[model samples]
Every structure is written in C-alpha cells, then in structure tokens.
Target: MRYSAGHKLETRERLLQSSALSAKRSGFSTVGVDGLMKAIGLSGAAFYSHFSSKDALFSAIVERELGQSLERLSGQGNEDRERLERCLKQYLSMAHVEQPESGCALPTLGAEIARSDVQVREQAEIWICRLQESWAQILQSESLAWAILSQCVGALVVARMLATPDVQRTVLKSSHEEIARQLAVQRAE
Candidate 1:
C-alpha cells in the first residue's frame, strides 16, 4: 500500500526522533541502518527512501538534537538569574546523568560528532554557537559563556564515565558550585 505524503513525513519524523535517542544511548557509529529501521518497525529499504545514507540520518539527528538544546538554552529557561539557576540545577542533577537519551546531545554524542563527516560536524557547530550566543546574552561575555558550557558538558561526560554514583554526584556538585561562584564574581565586577 502506498503511504500518503503526510504519512511518509510522519514516519520520517518518528525515525529521526527514535534514531536521535538511540544514537544518544549508543554512539552513532554503533547504530546500524537496519537496526535503526527495525527499531521504528520499518524495513531497511525504507530507510534509503527517507535518507540517502546512515551518515545523512546522523547529520539530521545532530541538527534536530542540538537545535533542541539551543532552544532550551536560549529560551525562557534562561530568562532570569533565578530561572537560570534552576535550569542549571536540573541540568547537572543525577536525573540528567541517568537519562542521556532524553537529555542534551553534547555530552552524549560530542565525541562521535568530532569523528563524523563534515556535514554532521557542521551541524554540531551551528547548534553549539546558537547555544553559546544564548548563554552570552546572559553572561555578556563569549569567553565566559564557552567556559560555562564546557564545564557543564564536561561534568556530564565525566559523570557518565565513572562507575560509581558518588563520584558522579561529586563531579556535578563541584562543577555547579564552581560555576555559581564564577557567575557571582562576574556579577560583582
């Protein structure tokens, strides 16, 4: 049976969304086209109909995931100092550590993106700059914005790497406290 245009579009979005989360859970390199298609209950042949190649899917997922991150960072989440603090609290929390699939893509897929094709890397760069710009709006310094972002992403990456929850929590706590102190100093000056 032939699917309508809207149905095809909906299927494509489902594939993209599922693949994005799967890639977050397992690096893009580790997820095969067949497995990805199977996860969405589509035959492998249908994948090529929607995407030229696996790399194309990876690129699309990077764009979609990072765009979401940009929205979270730039949107009302960072509206005021209180909101920003609340956002950061949740950002570095244990819950975020436990659920990388539904969380930010940077810490989960940054390394994979670094090794991906130019198109994928470019998508990564674009969203990163968008997020940086958003943070710069609040911090008023591009350098500080990058530093804060780096610390938060690094904290998450390390938290995911270690075997123990205690160490992970410590990483998150230390980074949170350090970032807060740095922000306070920035405000004073």
Candidate 2:
C-alpha cells in the first residue's frame, strides 16, 4: 500500500524525533539507520526515502530540537522571571543529567558534533547561536547570556561525568544558584 504525502511526512517526522532521542542516549555515531528504523516500526529501506543521508536527518533533528527550545523560551515574554528560573532549575536538575534521551542535545552530542561532518557541525553552530540569542534577549546582556549558557552546559557535562548522583545534584544546584545570584546582581547594578 502506498502512503500519502502527508503520511510520509508524518512518518519521517516520527523517525527524526525517535532518532534524535536515541542519538542522544547512545552517541549519534552509534545509532545506525537500521536501528532508528526499527525503533520507529519502519523498514530500513524507507529511511533513505525520508532523508538523503544520516547526516541530513541529524541536521533536521537539530533544527527541530532547537526550534522547540526557542519556542519555549519565547513563551516567557519579558515579565516571566520566575518562569525563567524554573526552566533553568529543571534544565540542570538531576533528572535531566541522568536522562540523556530526554535531555538537551547539546551536552549529549557536542563532542560527536565536533568530530562530525561539516553539515552537522554547521547545524549545531546554528542551534547554539539561536540558544544564545534567546538567552541574551532574556538576560539583556550578551556577556551574561554567554556566561549563563556556558555555565549551564558545562555544569551538565560535568555532572553527567561524575561518579555519584549526589555529586551531580550538588554541581547542578550550585551552578544554578550561582547563575541566578549573578543575574540578580547584574539587574541590581
């Protein structure tokens, strides 16, 4: 049976979403087309029909994930300071650090992207820029935005690499508190 164009698009999107999560949980390099297809209940043959190559799918996934994040950030408008704080708290929580599949793709895939092909690297760079821009608008300063972004991402990476859950939680809480304190100070001055 032949699927309609809309059906095909939906299937492709499902594949990309599943692949994005799988790639985050298991390094992107290790997530083959066959495994991704199996996870989505599709035949491996249908993979190429959706994307020209794995790299193409990776790029698309990056776009989708970043777009979702941007939309989430935009919803805060300008007055939702408490909402922003909660978002950061959730981002650096132990739950996020321990769950790679549902966590932000940046810390999970950053190392692999560094070694990946140009297309993937370019897409990653675009996502990073979008994230930074969104944060800059929220914090009202480019420097503070970069600092918060760096601290959040770096804290997650270190927390994940640590041996104990307590250590991870401590690092995350400390980083979150420090960023929040500094941002408050900046607003005061």
Candidate 3:
C-alpha cells in the first residue's frame, strides 16, 4: 500500500530524528542506513524514498539537530551574562558529559564532520555560525563569544574522552568555573 504525503513526511522525520540521536551516540560515519531504518521500524528500501543518499540524510539530521540545540538554548532566556554562564554550567554538567547520545551534537559530531562530505561540512558551518551568533549576542563581544564556545566544546570533548569519572568531573567543573569567571570579568569590564 502507498503512504500518503503526510505519512511519508512523518516517516522521513522519524528517520531523521532517530538517525540524529544514533549519530550522536555513534559517529555519523559508523551508522549504517539499514540500521537507522531498522531503528525506525521502516524497511531499508524506504530510506531512499525520503533521502537521496546517506549524505543527504546526514545533512537533514544535522539541520534538525542544530535547530533543536538553538531552541533549547533560546529557551534559557536572553540575559546575556546569565545566559553565557548558564550555557557553560549546563554544557559541562556531569549529565551532559556522561550522556553522549542525548547531548549536543557539536562535541559528539565534530570529529566525524571534520572528515565528512562537503555537504555535511557546509551544514556544520551553518550551525557553527548560528551558535556563534547566539553566543555573540549574549556576550556582546565576538572575541569573547568565540572563546567561550571554544572552551566549552574543548572541555566537553576532553571530559568525554577521559576514562575516570573523577577526571571527567574535574574537567567539567574546572572548565565551567573558569568560563564563568571569565564571563563575569567580561561583564564587569
């Protein structure tokens, strides 16, 4: 039986969401199209019916995931100083470090995207710009915004890599505290 347009759209969305979460947990390159389709309870044949290729699916998932990140950040409200501090606190929280699958895609997907297709790179660039912009708006200084984002991403990457929970917590707490101090100084200046 043929699915209607709406049903097809919903199916495609389901696939993208599942793929995005899976890609976060496992590197995007590691996830097979068949596995992703199976996770969504759809046949592998139906995969191409929505996306032209795996790269196309990756691009869609990146866009969707980035949008979700932005929405979450925005929901935290617009207090520049408070928002920047909150962003650091939340990003480096133990919960975020321990849960790769449910966390922001930037830290999880950055390495994979570095070796990804040009289309994926382009999408990543867009998300980076959006994140930078949101951060810049909060800090009111492009340089400071870039620094905070860099530090946050780097801290998360390192913390995630560490084998010991103590090391991970140390990295997260120290980095979060440092960023908070730096942002506080920026505000005072």
Which regions of candidate 2 fall more than 4 Å away from where they truly are? none
Tens-place lDDT per residue, model 1, 6-60, is 9989999999999998989888788788899999998898999899999888889
lDDT of 2 by residue, 100-153 (tens): 788787788888778878977887788778778777777777898788878988
> Predictions ranked by lDDT, top down?
1, 3, 2
Write down the worst ten-residue block by lDDT for model 1: 73-82
TM-score of 1: 0.96
For all candidates in order, the CA lDDT equals 0.88, 0.83, 0.83
Model 3 spans > 4 angstroms off: 74-78
- Judged by lDDT relative to the true structure, which candidate is superior, 1 or 3? 1
Q: Report the candidate with higher lDDT, 1 versus 2.
A: 1
Deviation from native of the Cα of residue 187 in model 3, angstroms: 1.5
**Comparing 1 and 3 by TM-score, which wins?**
1
Cα misplacement distance, residue 110 of candidate 2 (Å):
1.5
- 1-189: candidate 3 lDDT, tens digit per residue: 998999998999889888988899878888788999999997888899999999888888788887777776642464655665666688888899888888788899888778888888988888778878887877778888788788988999999999999999999989888887887788799
Looking at model 3, residue 52 earns an lDDT score of 94
